[model samples]
Target: MNKIFALSAGTLLLCQMGMAQQKMVADKIAAIVGDKIVLRSDIEGEMVNLQRSTVDNTLPPNAPCMIMEQIIAQKVMVMQAERDSLPVSEQDVDGQIENRIRYFEDLYGSREKMKEVTGYSIYQLRERFRQPIKEGLLAKAMQDKITSSVKVTPSEVKKYFDAIPKDSLQFYESELEIGQIVIQPKATKEMDQYSIDRLLEFKKQVQEKTSDFGRLAILYSEDPGAKENKGVYILNRNDKQWDPDFLAASFRLKENEISSPIKSQFGYHLIQCIKRQGDNITVQHILLKPNVTRNDLAEATKKLDSIRLVILNGKMTFGEAVVKYSDLPMAKFDGGMLQNRMNGSSLITIDQLDQPSERDIVLLLDTLKPGGISKPMPYIDDQPGGRNGVRIIYLKTRTHPHRENMTDDYARIQQRTLQLKQAEARDKWLREKIPTYYIHVEDEFKQCSHIAQWIGSIAKQ
Candidate 1:
């Protein structure tokens, strides 16, 4: 996800302590929205959180000004929500706040570790964040309500689509709408013994050698997020992605202590607790993917090949075979049709195809066109993940690049129209309601590009 160019809470909400702490006491009110104050720390905190939470970290150089502008917009929204008597209940606010907390906990390691990192526990964190989340949600709801009246017609969609210059199109190198039935390679007793022995040997390296765990993680860790990061990053206590058993295990460790191999849905891991705050902990970990040999791939492909043979020999239609025998739950239900993850069309542009699978699909589909099918071919999505598995693909369809029309692309246009209409509505609401809220610029950002329309002519950057 892109670093949301939105202005929001930056530095700290409420956390107990972290694995590490930034020494700078970076708290300064950059703007005020009704009773809510936007702080420089808030923006910085969010940037840190966003960097850790999501992928994209790019920011406009005048990010503080951008954030301050959002504060003004939010203040206007809060006032309007109150005046309109929008009934945002306490339970509603608490629910959203708790979800975020849980996500943070899971992300960082545990609630206690998160607290140690942030200097706040889960309960205190919730209390500190409740009003802000409520206000943020309320403002979002008001904006939603404001945009609810906006609508675009089919003609508008076509006009918008056609108005785009040919060169302006965001082109993918290639894309595919692929279907698969996956079967995970079974991890049996002997494999487990082999993996555990290997990890145990690596564990002995840290214990016997004059070295620490981070150095070991850098050399041998398979975790992409940690391997290059020197095994350090902040995670909130409430994150939901990590396994609960693993999280519970992480919370019990002291600094520099190594964990016994802990198994999760993904694979087995060996972790070294880096630091502990209250409910949070920072840890470096090494992950080992379960060994899968060519024999394993061949075993899966052989089964799929048999199924393909049965279909070709007229024992069953391809669709019937997909529904009955294919291991891919998602594709089996769809009769082996796949949706484009981006545009949601059945269309597969040339650039949308994934690598390894891309070359395979292109070669397999050389003679075929749209509404065609492919012979069973090996496709792997078998990353060490919760939903990891291997499959043989069936290419259902491929569409050439052409002008997007209603017959081929309704959902894409509708979603785009909806977003544009919403943006227009939000801009309209802010332009009208901002004067009611108290706002000030830091003098440096007074001359921003978009502020004068939202605020007034008094401040110039």
Candidate 2:
């Protein structure tokens, strides 16, 4: 049996549970699957989120019924996962909850602001989000277990592609594969010391009660997020999103204790731990990044320009230069080749290259032919090490727009074919599994045609 369940339990559950706590309306059970209960508030809450998410801010007439079915299906998968003793680690759940909190924090600009908007504190939100994320992970694990052995053949891929109507074939946009060797502008030792000393002074002011941490952050923190977030953040130790140095300093501090000064990729920071619960902690901090002087920028440009000359003169390969001279540690292993985030390939779409942050790269690509390299250009580094730097861009490949074909797009077609076969297997599994579970749907949603299969299982009740 193959199944293709795309129900996102976290999104559905978060909207439902978070809103359910705030609303005073009486809630009723919409359906029951085995020991699991689906509430009317769950459906209504998902509808609310959907309405809020849309461009026109509208929901379909069948939105409630559609959401209800998805929730029911998700609940079924979760219950089955539990029965099978499928394991989802608490650490993984905590990491996911932290990621979700960080997402909302980024949206609202701070944990405090997020609380103000959502009417729930970070701790309360975590408690609400934990179960849903856990359930979603469990459902995915069960799905993987079910589909672990599924595989497709070359012939199967061709058969699936040939069966598609020609008019329905997908048209791809032009994509560019560009690479680079980056050289980050460095601050002099004196400049680094100056920033650290400034943070130490801010720390002293806060400790002496001469200034509030938030006030100092507002005045002095150079972190762009801190400008809006008031330098406050909730972090989980296991979450990799935080800079390692920042995370280490944050966890090392006792509640109400301020760190002297810490250096991270972002720059210098003075941290104060506000609260801690198990693996999660909240902190307020002031950041200060050393100014990259014109001299420093020129130095980096000169270094990269020299490296570019060496590559141009056939003195060293770009990849060898990346290993020996490039400051970007991550690009070294990949031979300085840029990857398409969608498919993890060296090929990327032109439309995908239309990011405002990549505007410089796009402009440079306009003048570059395949295997051509550009002169040193100034750009902002948005990787783990956030700094302004110079880089020589490499135009590896440019793919033109074309219809989906077996030769150029075999991997894409094969993936689509495998998904169809998996969906068929899942459908077969559902037909067999649905009867084994005790399922019920209220008469209000009897009109939803897609849930007819689940509705048929009502006879077992």
Candidate 3:
């Protein structure tokens, strides 16, 4: 079976995932599984979407047949999910849709550009995605129910590793696990007042129709995403990711009303409410951070230097220092380790450190050995408001270049072993469950060997 067809880790998100939906004409049924129909146009749409989204316009052979098989599996799982009365909340589905819209808008540079390319308004796109997103959520729920109990043991992991042909073993680069304790200096009261007064002036200009809010944000907002999005955000009331103060300040403003400068964790913001629908609000804002002087940077470095002394003397562990003194709140929970955004692994490579600040820290680890801590170093912080900060680097572990093996790559092997076991379990379930469903395949697609077992029992028309 193609990896796409196997429900190993989880059900794949819908085929059009974040792709703009294109209208289809002259559609015909491609296949039917348990009353759920897969359209020929659906497969074509997926091909077009993949072409647009992928860097290389390349696809596997027999792509249509593979897509047909994948869709059949999804339809069967969705049917089972409904039969089992699995609950998928409308709120969750809506959130995913909204996020997808924002992603595509960012991809195309703006909502207007996205609308021009996709021939759909934001409202129309939401309606178009509703059913597909709901179905995907149901399929994922059923997949989790089926494979939730699957597990792998140490022996199974070794067995999986041994079965891989020695010549085909993957080679890994030198990777490092790094930790840090950062300190950010506070700006003086004079600087804070300066930022607040600047925002108040911008608000007055917008209120007096002397300048545009978005233009001001584009030219002045310190938020990094403001460069691409013009400081615009579609916010949800229940979303905990937004700062409480910022959320409250934005929500209090009526449409077209600009708020007085308000302080949030990031900095001071001047918010202008564009539209609101129930708990969702569309707003634009300008974020400004108070300037830090040379003296302040030196003070922050001195503070981190002291924390480094405590850590080196064994009075406190690096993690303890991070929890007690690091300026970044979330770093404490992660033990100050920089994690790979793709896999959440503490072990990461120079390339995996996408941010320039993170890469700079790793580059400085040449003289430090494993379990060694470096002296206080100043680096620019990469956050919404870029700020100068000081940090001490701790190199936890380092791995040399080597071929895949049981000792060096146990975690990676164990994960792969678990996925294989889950795939087997999923296939076994499908072998039994497929017979119970009313399945039909077009003659052209019946030639796909991968799906032979699925449609073999159905008599030819």
Candidate 4:
């Protein structure tokens, strides 16, 4: 699991104290693994975070013990990663930062709101999270490296399942296999031209000093993820998250230069390059998506409905229809099947279908039986760079609640078995590796049962 290091209340309080010129107690070292020191503040910070995150806002009795052990494990992995010279690229770090920032933006509704609540700008937050995220990624990479070769055979999987007591077997909810044939509503050429013209006007205003680019972005940018930050972004030339057209336009500008309206998949943008540092550039932009009119939606719906009729009449298979007509790049490539993000399987539970954005689709799915297809339905694609569209849902299969079994849930069982095998391998590796490194825990935490192995190993050292 990847660990996210969030700023806890304790850290915020310390920051506030510092800003007020108040003297605060210094943080103490709680433990040391090799040359890595885990500070008392780190433990307290995590404890506070865990307490706040729990249902009743309380930490478990053994929370400190658990947290400390996890920290020790992570530190040990980090030491090994460093020793082995594990590589973490700058692009990977930037990607993580972007994802973290996007998550907070969703949570707080906007970057400005997040900054107001957290008392830190997005850039500052990224800088603070940079080291921790990098270290966490390194630790995870090391763990994966250690467990990469561990695999469970068919016999081992059956043995693992047989070993589980009958009463303790896991129960699964009713799951559905769903697929879709999507058609994106496209704006008319006139509407697209209007959007470009509007952005061009905005560019003129910015160049003439009649309006501020950032101010205009805050007011007019449709890129919700960046609007609250005045549409600011620090982008690398090779970052895949950016649209090629937008990226190219951004890189073409000189410092303090504004570009003409550029059209990308997301929409039209007027970009102002703020600064350039080698391959990295900071730019401010205002985005405006072309108006996808009701006519556009109706046209898309009609097209999807026609495709659905052809599939139902056996003139074309659903997968063939997906390949021929679907505009969704990712789903089209996979025959329009919707896979569970957790397990990377097409099987999804009804409860998983209860997400607010998927409620309409769930209702449509309720009317569908196995191998059934629904009429084209309207849905706003909530994905990044998504737009309003119509799609026909395909219900491929649905399974009922059942105990763990080979026939109904072989893939899940196999995954669980493999995980157990990998965990055993990880423990064996740790046992062999820990003694080679310098390890110490605080005297107070020596009572933790899991720490005994480390303590014993230290004694041997």
Candidate 5:
């Protein structure tokens, strides 16, 4: 299993304290690979994090030993990455830390609650995570380098499958290939003007000092993150994720100055530059999306209804219909097929449809058979600016629960085979690299059977 080096702020703080408090005895090194060392507290900290985060609040037997091995491997990889001069940028590391902070803040309800729970301010959390996050990035870079060229041929996949005992073969639940054609109703030009005017008014209020930008954002911003973040975001000018128009507008503003309402894909926004430091800019904005009236939605429904007829009448393929009519951004690439978010596979299970909007459509799947398309139904699109939209679902294929077989489950088996091959390649690389490093294991962990190879390497040294 691939283990990510992610510990919550609270756990990380405790671990840091443990290392500091143990200074009287001198923080013991659990193991060393090349110039990288794994501190004893690092293992304990990860154990605590895993125990708390696990679904059952329990850990597997020998979990510590497993964690020790994983951490040592990471250290080795990080050392190799440095030798190879893999480029892990400060911007990338900071971006990961910022994302983690936002995630925990969302989890704990707000920034205040997150600070209360974690006992660390965002800045402190960033400082604590910086090294570990950077090390993780380096390790990942090395792992990717090791496995980059590994591939499995069809014969190898078949051979791997044949080796699995018949009775031990995997069982699979029913899966589905679901497709959709989403149509977001366009607001009339008058409604668009109305939204733009509202944002302009908000900008005027802030400029006149009648109200602050954050207060107006809290009250009126349609952005989901506005409730907690008050429409504030730290943006990197070079990050491609931000809407180009929005980013350009933000970069144009002077610190403490608010912009006239600017339109982006999401809607109209009045952005205030809170701070600027080189490429990183902190900004607050109030977003106002144009309202979609019942008539607008009905028109979209009618249009989808017409498109559905064209598909049902065999006049157009579902893929063609999606290409010509679907408004979803991903439709251009995926032809409206919903993919498993975890794996990007078209095959999805009912349980995988966890979002409310997806569940609504999943309920309709009970009546849909292979190649069946449902009537256009109204759903609130879950995207940032997607308030209300209409969609028609296409059930391309449905699988019955069964034992895995080469014929029915080739794709899944192929994926597993490829993963196994990659793991083998990584192990081979580790075997070749370990002997070249100066290895060490403290007396406490010397008896861990999993580390015997490292201990032997140390003996050879």
Candidate 6:
């Protein structure tokens, strides 16, 4: 099931549980919220990705009947959110939009190509998606309201562990202990001026031809992924993954319009709007980041070299330097530590490291035993706003696979226990609220085995 999820989603926001045989679509005017209509498409689209990978590809009358009941219940909660004037922030939407773009980018390959295939620019796709994404996020929040209060005592966890048969227990494939140091090179005045000068010249050329925005992107844009997208990205209304300045400026453009140079931490961008629909827009952009020079990189490396020497000489410790110098906020509190992002395990496994850091760290660690330090070396972390850096790391500790026990796996166990509690609470909420909503399951599904549980009180047997 996990493998199926990976194949279908690779990081899609949708959550799925292993279910069996469910293939059906309906066009019922299921319910209405003030001015909005809830069609079968809305409910079923939410589950299409789920059913695609579930063990049961067949749509049992029982499962659809139960899910339809849940859908109507979700609508009621969304309606309540509207009535209460609950709001979602633009920051959140931008982040979500970016995440969706990445998913589809992975799905379709290249943002521009996705635009060509989907027949909607990234912006247009995102705008159309914005409301649905918001609706989904809001619905989840509402679901949380019902399930948030559920809690499990220590006894519940022991019971949960006991309930699982010995052979049925889940064993993690592996774990790792990792140490890292990072040094970020500063952008220089000359490189910044050069990039700004190029944009200024490009703006002149754009003004001269006006019809060749796409052509210019092909020739000069440095953003490799989006350039393949023809310098264009779709904006979805509920997308939450974009840089804010990028999102706002794109939406503000008029059709066939070129925007002024927009600068962000990523670099400089020149935007051309291809189309617009309400809050969403499809726009192409050329990005040029000032590249760090050899001297600038050398300076950062030199600094790390000094730190490495000090630690090796016993003047200072690697953890102390990490506390003093690492810029990553998430790593700062952990003493500039490197952990497997998948599970936050201190040791990164061979398969877990995707960047050059994995090989570099392994080689560095091979030369040192526990409590030993590595020389300053270059490493790259694939993160937004991540850049080339040099740092020294210390091998803190290492662990090997063992039977799951309380001392080493407390956090993972606690989370699973909480999830079990939450699932039960959601079921309890459905049992109580199912009768209150105006629900009318298709008569074909009414006699299914699960229908009574979905709609609360059952008729006499």
Model 6 lDDT per residue over 181-252, tens place: 677776788888888888778878878876477777888887775545677776765555577788888888
What lDDT is reached at residue 73 by model 2?
66
lDDT for model 4 comes to 0.79
TM-score ranking, high to low? 3, 4, 5, 2, 6, 1
**Model 5 global lDDT (CA atoms, 0 to 1):** 0.81
lDDT for position 200 in model 5 = 83
Model 1 local distance difference test score: 0.63
Give all candidates' CA lDDT scores: 0.63, 0.79, 0.80, 0.79, 0.81, 0.64
Tell me the tens digit of each residue's lDDT in model 2 across 41-133: 777787878888799998988787778767766777788889999999998887788767776776677666777778876667777777788
**Residue 320 CA displacement from its true place in model 6, Å:** 9.7
Model 5 segments more than 4 A misplaced: 1-28, 52-57, 85-112, 121-134, 153-167, 185-189, 202-219, 223-258, 271-285, 293-336, 339-345, 383-386, 458-461
Which model scores highest in lDDT? 5
lDDT of the structure predicted as candidate 2: 0.79
Off by over 4 Å in 6: 1-26, 30-38, 42-47, 55-62, 76-87, 116-119, 147-149, 177-181, 198-220, 225-262, 269-286, 302-349, 355-375, 380-387, 391-398, 448-461
Task: Write one digit per residue (lDDT tens) for candidate 1, span 1-461.
Answer: 11121232212342212212576574788666667776666656555554454456666576655555665676677678888988888767766776677667766876567877777756667767767777777676677678788888888888878887877755433445665555656666677777777778778888887666677767766676555576565444664446777787777678888888888765677877878887667877777767666677677667777876676577877678777765554665576655665555666665566544345665666766543444545555533234334555566545455555556556777778778767776876665566656666566666766565545732321
User: For residues 102-175, could you state the per-residue lDDT of candidate 3 as single tens digits?
Assistant: 65766688777887887776766677777877888887788889999998888888888889999999999998
Which ranges in model 3 have alpha carbons more than 4 Å from their true place? 1-14, 17-24, 48-58, 82-134, 183-194, 201-257, 271-286, 292-303, 306-335, 341-344, 379-388, 447-450, 455-461
My TM-score estimates for the predictions, one after another, are 0.53, 0.73, 0.75, 0.74, 0.74, 0.69
Predicted structure 6, TM vs. truth: 0.69
Instruction: For residue 354, give model 5's deviation from the true position in Å.
Output: 3.0
| Model 6 alpha-carbon miss at residue 387, Å | 4.1
Q: Between 1 and 2, whose TM-score is larger?
A: 2
Using TM-score as the yardstick, the better of models 1 and 5 is: 5
